[model samples]
Target: MEFSSNIKKLVMLVNVTNSPTESEAAEDAHQAMLNISIPQTLKYSGVRTQSGTDIECSANETILCDLGNPFKSDQKASLIIIFETSGITLFTEQITSQLQLSTISEQTDLLPVPVTLNVKNTVLTMFSLEKQVMDTSFSGSVIGESAMNSTRDVGSPLEFVFRVQVLGEPLGDLGRLVIDFEWPFAVSNGKWLLYLTEIVIRGQSESHCVPPGKIVNYLNLTLSKEGTKRNKREVESVYPHAEASVTVLTTRKVPQFLDCWRQTALCQSFSCPLSNMSTQVEVRVRARLWNSTLLEDYAKALRVEVKGKATLRLLTDKPAIKMENHTREFTVNVDPVLGEEKPYEVPLWIIIVAAVAGILLLGIISLILWKCGFFRRASRREMYEAKSQKAEIKIQPSETERLTEEF
Candidate 1:
């Protein structure tokens, strides 16, 4: 709807028609006015001529104007009427007022016939409408980050946290909040490197007076992967626990083959009439990592670069809230520890075979030495007997020689 000051200031174009004699035309022109019947609800301000000159006026009283002299030939004039009131019109309400030419001049036969006019139907809806606005701020980061540096082990869990805060009471209706995430690594040879697993949402209002479950009544959260909705049943089941002390959780395995970029999005909407209160919403997204990824591994650490953006929109036809997209970029240092090595051990059968071989070689060497007399020793009794026998034989031979000499 359009707004203008003319809505309060009324303008009328007046015309007079009569065929008067030369004597009447020669007479002096006189001042005139139109009797106005305005509604009692209206508080009339002063009036003005077409040239913006002030004219005395009263509430529900006469509107003094300068219509051209009726005693002369046909002529025209304009009257500017200004008024004010406190009443406001709704969608289709209107106001009406009646205006009639003064009877004093009409009784004196100044004009040929009576002139009557009415103010056109006027509606002041544009003046009553107020622009809807809300002040908000958005931010996102890795949960355990320190100076923009984060760490995640290979095949371990990673989390991303996002928050939105309202500085004042929201005059406009709340719409969906969209957060888009693009991972640093992608699918490797049709295998998933990393994918979203679960999403958690928490809220607080009234300067943190309201807790997670109570604020669930005002929130509607959803999860999406590659532009497709996920966890419909899980998200719906949380509504029954609006008053419970539970946070909203939606769990789903992001489809790996659907997209290579691992693009995921989360959306949240809210109800209205949260009066004179501050609202804060937090979102935590958890993902699983695989050993194989396209990220660069340096010095036993895989450094992955991640980026994401968050946007908040109002469910209004004409929005006055000005919000900027929340953006974040960070690096994750992943340490994939390698396994330890063990010592080699010999088998029991090999030990037994080596022992048997050594025993057999010793036995064979002893038998060969005995056969070659290297280990044999003669008896000492046999050597002494042989020496005694030799001495007896020498004495017996000398006796035989003595017998021969006696003969």
Candidate 2:
């Protein structure tokens, strides 16, 4: 079975004509006709959509639009409009618009109509948005140093002021900023206790829209000496009871890192002493940019890392003394004990004693020799007299023989 019915079509028409008459009634009629067409002209003015240039339509996206009217006239009207869509669901959605219509009056014949009307749309979603890190940089320096004792001791306390500057721009909603400072195990040669005494941070930003609310003003960091094997072994050999201590004003356990935001400068004073005779200390600083709610679960996709180093010398405080060279010239004085010529005089008693001892020794030796017949000698005068007597007797005998021969 087929059913057919005649649908009634409704059509209406009105004549629009204008004529110039020298009468007030004709002018009033012309104004009334213009007013009647204002609503129809506004209805066909069209809807203009305004949004971000980089907009990519996704779930729960906010879109802004403006409604423009093309007519220039003084007329008042109220609009109640509804939007209908198909094949999509909205969660916690709201649409708002602001409209102002001009009033039509006899005194004011023509008025400018507002061309644009502003509207806002909010769309809610269940998924979170991803953040982006724009730029990052870090720098650090050693500001000053303080020694607790006048004479450096093995476990004496030394303080150093370290300043670190962190700069970054987070394109998405900022989550957290972390700054890490790593001191080398050889900083104190494991002989001294090293720890942070105080930490102060100040934050600044190029964009005024971002405040310094998420900054962490203070952080206490305690580094482990166990990380350094060589220095710890040497320290244990010298001081068996030596152990690293936390020097921070608070007794809380030291944090390994610090969290903050934007362009920031952190100044920290560390208390470390020359536990042994270490002359230099070295420290490393690392900064990370994180976009996450918690510090440990930092977003690796939008993270930045920067590193720096600082070295402190213990002997920088001592003053150096230089020795001046000098030359000396000597001149001998001739008028005194150094130059006066005097003969070396022997003692009279000593000379006499020496001479008498020599004479006694000579006499004793002579008397002993004479007693032993060592000086006996023959008589030359007696031998000569006996020879002369023998010669005279021989002469007498020869004279007697000569006399007898003559007789």
lDDT to native, each model: 0.38, 0.25
Residue 47 local lDDT, model 2: 22
**Residue pairs in steric clash, candidate 2?**
154-275, 191-275
Per-residue lDDT tens digits for candidate 1, residues 196-284, read 44545555432212222333212121322322122435323321112323233222222122122344222122222223323556655
Q: Per-residue alpha-carbon lDDT of model 2 for 125-203, expressed as tens digits?
A: 1111111111221111111113122111122122222322211111112112222333221111121112222222322
Give candidate 1 misplaced runs (Cα > 4 Å): 1-32, 51-71, 89-92, 103-264, 275-407
Scored by Cα lDDT, where does model 2 land?
A: 0.25
Q: Which ten residues in a row have the lowest lDDT in candidate 1?
A: 123-132
Residue 304 in model 2: lDDT: 26
